[model samples]
Target: MLIASSRPLAAAFDLALVDLDGVAYRGPEPIDHAASSLMAARASGMQLLFVTNNASREPESVATQLSTLGIPAEPDEVMTAAQAAAAVLTRRLAPGARVLVVGGAGLLTAVRAAGFEVVGSAEDKPEAVVQGFAPELGWRELAEAAYAVQRGAWHVVSNLDLTLPNERGLAPGNGSLVAVVRAATGVTPVSAGKPEPTMFTLGAQRAGAHRPLVIGDRLDTDLAGARAAGYPGLHVFTGVSSARDAVLATPDERPSFLGADLRALLVAHRAPERSGDGWWVCGAAAARVVDGRLDLRPEGDRTTTLDLVRAACGAAWEAVDTGSALDPGSIPDLAVHEA
Candidate 1:
């Protein structure tokens, strides 16, 4: 492993597996400082890989989306739940094994490309039933999957995430699909995505790194996945999770490190100060020290001093999104003195 003197803990890690939707970008917009944080990590000699449980898109398409958001990434650096499911099946089952696929084209393509013979219909009584996110899933598909699984075929699912974040809001994801099949077949599927060791193992193998860090916004998937893989994780609050959630997280779902945003975490590795007298601001929200206490402003407001601090934090985070360094000027009316 490459070693650095000042940041020993950071240097110990050689690889980073980050989440896409909630951690880096939400819907079409990239999270503030998402790109810069990744670029900084890359410069620090950490190999970056985007591991996502969203099985809706292909790897190349995911790469393109990241690039469009000003994030420098490659297809090889992206691994989706669909790809993981395919890898598991390819390694375990024989070549050209007849399989029933109940999901979108991404899962079907991955499985087929991995040498599995995918059957649209279960008429052939396939050797396996692979389930993933299918927006148009109907009763017929569920029945077929149950039939195939009941026949002794291996049951596999891309992920168990109950929902996925989109522009409109959270929507039913692969986990919901797996639930339907499970209810029908009375069998639990082998999960191949986040919180499952399969994806982490596959990603680490591909990146060829001994020590890897998992970064994301959600504690359940990203942090849980890292825990399952025995790796450290950096939790950012730019997505689904809030500071309140962190405070109340169960032992297994808590993150190793928590940050307001990716850039802020990279700048300082200190844990958030939590005391009865202190005010708590989640992520990039605004806060000001008054009477030995912090008064935090709500998100998307820029009128008060707290709002200004929030805006400053937002600007600094935006700079990171564009792969730039954090500038003190980005946060207005704040004095910075070297300790």
Candidate 2:
């Protein structure tokens, strides 16, 4: 831990590269304190840069939704995977190059803005196939993409998120659709979304941030991408991952800081310190795995639940670093106590 922040995270980092779905909002609903936290961060002079894998909506649309939710954002402040995938094409294909768009209007607009001619079918002999998430996508679209890839055309997918969250529930994401084309054409697309560090770098550069901290809810994509880009990541439990997921994460998947929501930015983040035999966090809790059983020592005067939670996480992660985590039965103990 880097000397544990005495001040809030809003003052600790110059910018925050945030994820969309899980971090900011779960579909149309806002995560608790997400908007207010972002507003406070911005008020403290920290820049907000939204990095998202959802490619169906345009950046302007995403910003509009954020504004509606009380966190005002501009179109340029949002970076979509479509723009990142389009960047890959700009680096390869020349101007006027035809690329078959297998997603929605956002993707088509990106390719066209990148000086490429958008096509719908392989009959156009597109030089590449760019795929993304769109609700209207079906078997015909996947078949068209497969045909383009089979004809020796390059394939690029905005993201490979298998499940997409919405107002209803988790639905088939672009990754599932990409799998269809992959199975048919036996070709995997070059990914340009989270877990691929390139987009994070681009997002920070766009925001002109010197030291940016990535805040999100997913370990595989948001946290992993931050690590891949040589940046520190803070995990918030507003979506996708749980406390069990964090403590049990592999070396590459571990997060630097953990919190319940975006509001963690407004307070000090004190990482647990080492103690004898196990680890101590917040001076109120001690946890260790003894003979494959997780032992929790709740000290006197446990003031904040978040502090206890942090301590448990620190000890849990320390244990997992050397050995395995305790059984699944102990997972609930680490999970936050909901009211």
TM-score of each: 0.76, 0.93
What lDDT tens digits, residue by residue, belong to model 1 across residues 118-235?
A: 8976678788888888687778888888888988889988899998887788887778777878887789889888888777888999999887877788878887787888877776
Once fitted onto the true fold, the runs of candidate 2 whose alpha carbons sit more than 4 angstroms away are: 1-3, 299-304, 323-326, 337-339
Give the winner by TM-score.
Answer: 2
Which residue pairs clash in candidate 1?
33-321
- Model 2 residue 310 CA deviation (Å) reads 2.8
Q: Report the Cα lDDT for candidate 2.
A: 0.83
In order, candidate lDDTs are 0.70, 0.83
At residue 63, what lDDT does model 1 achieve? 92
Sequence-dependent TM-score of model 1: 0.76
| Clashing pairs counted in every model | 1, 0
For residue 125, model 1's alpha carbon misses the true position, in angstroms, by 1.4
